[model samples]
Target: MLKPKRTAGSRDLAAIEMRRSLAQRIKELTEEPGEHLTPIPGLSLYHRTSPTPCFRASYEPGLSIFVQGRKRILLGGTEYLCDGWSFLLSSIDVPAQSQIIEASEKTPLLSIFLRLDMPMVREVLSRDDIPEGPPSAHRQGLVVGETTVGLLRAAMRMLELLDTPEDIPFLSPLAHREILYHILRTPQAGRLRAIATSGDLVQRTGRAISWLRENYAKPLHMEALASTARMGVSTLHHQFRALTGMSPLQYQKQLRLQTARLRMLMDGFNATTAAYEVGYESVSQFSREYSRFFGLPPIRDVKALKNVNTALESVV
Candidate 1:
């Protein structure tokens, strides 16, 4: 028997239905105009009513799917833009600047974020049924790709569990595994697989990254990091930059500045104290670098953030 060819109209209708279903599910989960954590572990919903300025934050390993509006994420000098039909994946921890580039009061920005579990990914990869591919050397850890129907459906099933909490314990894990399988079958799978596989250059770089994350407040020595990753100094530097989009020193500086900002905002620390707490030797250098990174000095930036929070609270 011969199968009939599918028409473009049918395909467009399918895509429209997928987007509509996902948008409805997300809106049900997100009741307000902010990030909302769902019952399913590692799954969260985000809703924004208007476009916002770029904000700096650490993006851990995860997958983000947008069902409405669009976003721009800046990693070093590269910018990744994604809309309702696309998604973003981060294979490792990265410091990034993200902005909501498109949104409105009526048609808000709606999205879902699920933190990737490396252990589960590794288990899935170990199965003999998984396809094998050659490892990539120069690929960055962050990638944006179009979302597939299978992946989107699996994600929607996972979100559906939020409405029926009793079913989550048994079915959520399976749905998550299916989602990972679909991701591993994408074109950007090589980088994600390398992050979990042993002895791969990307995995070795991840080890170094783990070390830096653990000891970001300490003085860094390239030799020590290279030894820990079991790579030559030159190779380590090359691979680290290839994966992270920044040199090791620059990466450390981002961590320090971000941490200092948090300390001032949450712990009520002064500029000098926050600098010292994050391993800054010279307060003057810290202030200069902080201003350059955040576009304002410590006191002014902190004050502005507090004022914004206060105004939002008053409105609420």
Candidate 2:
């Protein structure tokens, strides 16, 4: 006997069920209200109860598949919302402000994040069968794309591998390839592709960005950065801004400030100590810039964060 033809409504219902199932899996894997690293390297699950204030955060090259809740992320100057209906992909490390805008005890935010392996992406892209995705019009480092059923299914397969750790070592790569292949086959693959392509301008600029991230505490030398990118100073500056929406100096500043903020908030570093630790020679100058960037001085900002944490802890 032949099966009955499925209607569009049935397809939509199936998709909804799959998302709910994925969300439940994430929630089960994360029994606490924090990040839970899985057996899969660089793959983690997150659960958050209640909305959160904006905080300084950095994105590694990764995929964020949000099965529930929503977040507001300001990357560079653009704002993106990551929710059950959308997936966020980052092609490189970037400093940004993010807030959990929709979450609660009754309906906590549950999601999966997988750090992208550039080498793996390149290998997958080299396959004879893989389609060359559409050329990107704007090559921003971070993009939010509407989720599709195929992508979800691939992600679900990866998540299931957690059930059999022994199988993961052999099977995880294949699953990772499928997830990446899904993205690469779409128009959204541009940044990931460009960065993975050897000697591509974006790839070179990505090297410069990585160097800046590693050495933000040291004095930035334009010549050294340009040399790392293997591009002229002017070209490096233009391309850096094109992909990251900031100059090299500006990116370094954000990285420095965010580092100092974390040190002060988490490591008991005072304002002057944090400032000098992050390569600021003058504490007063650091104070001025810190205030300008974070909307408050270091002491006040840290105090606010602690209080927020306390309130959240009490609720939890």
Candidate 3:
């Protein structure tokens, strides 16, 4: 028996239905307005009732898909905006600022985040079925792309495991693999592939990044960094800047400033204490740098952040 041919209209309708299904499932999983961690490892859901102040945080390698509303992420000097039909991928650990740009009490921002498993990514790449692409040298570690039905369906199924807890152990891996497979085939594949490819400049830059992260408080020696990355000094500087959009020293400064802010905000450390703790030799220099980075002096910024938190707590 011959099967009926599918029409373009039918395909369009099916895509619409899938989007609706994804939105419904995501909303169901995120019932309240907060970050919700799930039973599955490295999977989380987020919701917000209104527009939020820009948030500075570091993102590990992961994928974030918004089912409702929009977000803007700032990496160094670049800005990326994504809506319900789009997704963002961070191929490496990066410190960035992001904010929910579109949301309301009635139609809050709902989103899901899945951390990428590098081992699984390598496994997929090792398969002979996967196609090869030109190696990318200067691609940033972050990418935003419009979503497709196949990717949406896979993500929805991964979320569905939240309701069917019993099936998660067996089915979650498969769902995650499917999601990665779709991502690998996207235009961002070259950058993503380069992150995992051995001896690639991006991978070497990543090694340098890892060392900086681990030794951020120590004095930065250019020769040491170049040796750690197994690259020449000039190549390390150029490739590191190309991949991360900042010089190594600038990146270290970001790490130090962010860490100091967290210590002051969360650990009740004072400006001088926090500054020195993160390797700032001079309190005045720390204050100057902190003000430049966070738009206020250390003491004032901490007070402002505390007030914002207090206001949010009162609202909640």
Candidate 4:
């Protein structure tokens, strides 16, 4: 069956304009070289220039829409590309690498990140009459969807709050809730549904993912995890791979490697100690895997990161 063409409503157009305005506001705020941390609580704006591959963790689940450049995020083995016209939504905290694919000194990658809140998501889901989805299947945690006017408008309204600090304390939550409501009702609702509706297989798989993130270095017992997620082992495996683009084990390995890298950078832990901390047993095995993943040995990679930090500090 063919899908019908989706149209943006008047409200959606308003959202686009609002995003443009917000982008302008962010640019104005950051006339100098530094990140502009928005005054709005739980929300932030990102502006990056120099083209390079940087790894980031989505600590807060939110929507990332770029107005100027493109970003490629590797979640598990699957890759998602989001540009000006598309939005990337990740509902879970998964370790990933995002590279700036397109950016220039003139037109940098301009983006607005709305920090998603569990209370707001649940509140919207409570009152809204969201459409019933097909029998739940494992849905990917991150997806690239065509932007809609309605979605954009809600974001714009939320951004407008930045200019009025007093309004934020009372109205910000309401605006954020409206955004979630719009998402729940849009065609992209499936992505929201896969995560929003709890206890379904996909939701269960999400729980499993949360567990892996916190217990990255620990042994992954599928049966035990499945039990915790209220799913069977077979079902858990299928859903976990489908949503994350990698099996549970692969996801765990990535987390371990990323954590070890951070340890080396911040605490000056050597390869052996860092490996042990992140659950690797043999020193040789840790170095081999670290090299394969990061393109350099632990010590070399740490040194390179330190140098880069120094250079950035000097410029700042």
Candidate 5:
């Protein structure tokens, strides 16, 4: 791909340095194949080969960038992919499944995950000259965007702090803010701007999502949720579906099933118990839905996941 013309400014110089640093950091961090490393506070980096087609998992507000290979994510039946030149940004909580689709032993997939903290979001929003109005609603929680010089640079600086632990306490937050600024100034800024703003429809929808995440197993009333989000029931339903591509009920169901699967796999709960814990009342209904969602019966699915974990441990 042809390089975009670089501007002649100090920011440009800093951006170049930043990109070089990021590329080097990614190379060093990804040196070992099949390793997942959490290099810094709230940042998880990984290099993988032959990763499974992962199920839709609850995604916290975060930024995800792939330095090599590719990732495909499915959200609300929509598919999105990001590769070396692209990044995926989720500005709010979402239910999605993602997998490294283009990696092998010869060339492992490389990626980084950054946690989104509300304090930093507020700090970024506090700056003067804030952009006004709600950004257009985008249904896909994962968005693939062309990686810019600015963002690449900030990402590198953030990783560079890993080598200088002392600076992390002071510099990491600033670098993170720069990264967010880079994002807000990009073409996809509108989507993020919507997320950054307080009391916007998107942010309101985000509140509802947060509540469901914490109370997935508990029964929910539409009006109650609407009230919590500060929107009327009808408007909440319309905007929620517009932003997530699923009605509130569908979103809750996805969360319920995903959480139930985790309870079974990680906590070793029986299928019936897991289903009930996740708020499913009928064991038969749970079994049928679990099978449909996971493409295997609950017992078999748990067993398969355990086998996979065991095999990975053996290799390690």
Candidate 6:
């Protein structure tokens, strides 16, 4: 097998130094304890001063570059740990549970999150220079890959634009493109390319997933979903599970539960109110499943989550 011009071994030494450089800039820019949106569109810096409780999160199509500490995320049955050496590419919107596994006031978890430009990715994939590889069997929306020197360099340059605000207007887009190019150069690009392509099976499955995400509260009809994806019922089910690791019903259930949890926790809704609001017909059914899913009854879970942040307050 022919390797790319910059092999894995070649990028290692430089990537180590580059990660340190990027981490410093990110930490300095994100003085607050949460995600800080940058001047550049679709880019954000995250800083966590302490390990956190597992929280439900929805990851849009983006890249998460971790430069310090670690995070553990569970998507379906798979558990992924992202530390300083790696990055996670989300080719589609995915619901998961994530927690900060490593961090402290002295050494915070520093990361850069940049949303993908599917059009830009498609443009790069169209270039004559990018060789067509054999079809990849990989279909998961989220994939982890080693952070290369090129990726770190691109992210650092993007972050630097924060200092010179004027340059960001003209230069940030170029930096964003550069970051996308580095992502395409990795093996995980195969999954990204599938989503970017117009009519690929994975892309079709992505459409159904998107529909499910947007309309999870509505009654699900397999025929309508298969029609949306331009796939037969069996084919849709197979490809959907292949790409998302969850059946459509299972996916919708999780989405409903997470949304209900958020409403109750953040919006001050009660258990019964939150249940019916998220399309549940019965409060008893919602409570039963909520306990099974979150390991606590609704009121208790919300109460526990409220206190979960107390640990971080001490560090502040």
Q: Cα lDDT of all candidates, in order?
A: 0.81, 0.82, 0.80, 0.72, 0.74, 0.83
lDDT of 1 by residue, 202-272 (tens): 67777888888789999999999999999999998898887778888888888899889888987999999
**Runs in model 3 lying further than 4 Å from the true structure:** 1-17, 39-41, 103-105, 123-138, 198-200, 314-316
lDDT of 5 at 39: 45
lDDT of 2 by residue, 1-316 (tens): 1111334563486678889889888887787899999888789899999888787788888988887898988867778878776778876676677899899888999888999887898888888898777666656677877566777889899999999999999999899988887777555777567657625787788799889888998999999899999999999998888777789998888888888988988899999899999999999989999999889988999899889878987887
lDDT (Cα, tens digit) per residue for candidate 6, span 187-236: 87776677677367766877888898889888889999999999899998
Residue pairs in candidate 6 whose N, alpha carbon or C atoms collide under 3 angstroms: none
Please report the TM-score between candidate 5 and the true structure.
0.75
lDDT of 4 by residue, 165-227 (tens): 889889988888877776665556676655566446766776788888889889888888999
TM-score pick, better of 3 and 5: 3
Model 4 residue 126 distance off true place after TM-score fit, in angstroms? 7.4
lDDT of 5 at 94: 76
- Which sections of candidate 5 miss by over 4 Å? 1-24, 27-44, 47-50, 102-106, 116-140, 304-316
| Candidate 6: C-alpha RMSD after superposition | 4.1
Error of 2 at 310 (Å): 2.0
CA displacement after TM-score superposition, residue 191 of candidate 6 (Å): 2.6
What TM-score does each of the candidates earn?
0.77, 0.85, 0.81, 0.76, 0.75, 0.85
lDDT of 6: 0.83
Each candidate's clash count: 0, 0, 0, 4, 1, 0
Supply candidate 2's per-residue lDDT for 223.
97
lDDT of 3 by residue, 76-188 (tens): 67788877767787867776777787877677788889988888889999999998876655377677766667888888889888889999999999999999888777666
* Candidate 5, poorest ten consecutive residues by summed lDDT: 1-10
The candidate scoring highest on lDDT is: 6
Compose the digit string of candidate 5's lDDT tens values, residues 1-316: 2112233562455554654466557768667765455546678786776555466566677787666677777787787777766667776777777666677665557777888776787778777875643464555565666667778867887887888888887887888888888877766676666555535787888889889878888888999999999999998898787667788888888888888888888788998899899999899998998889889998998899888768755654
Rank the models by TM-score, top first: 2, 6, 3, 1, 4, 5
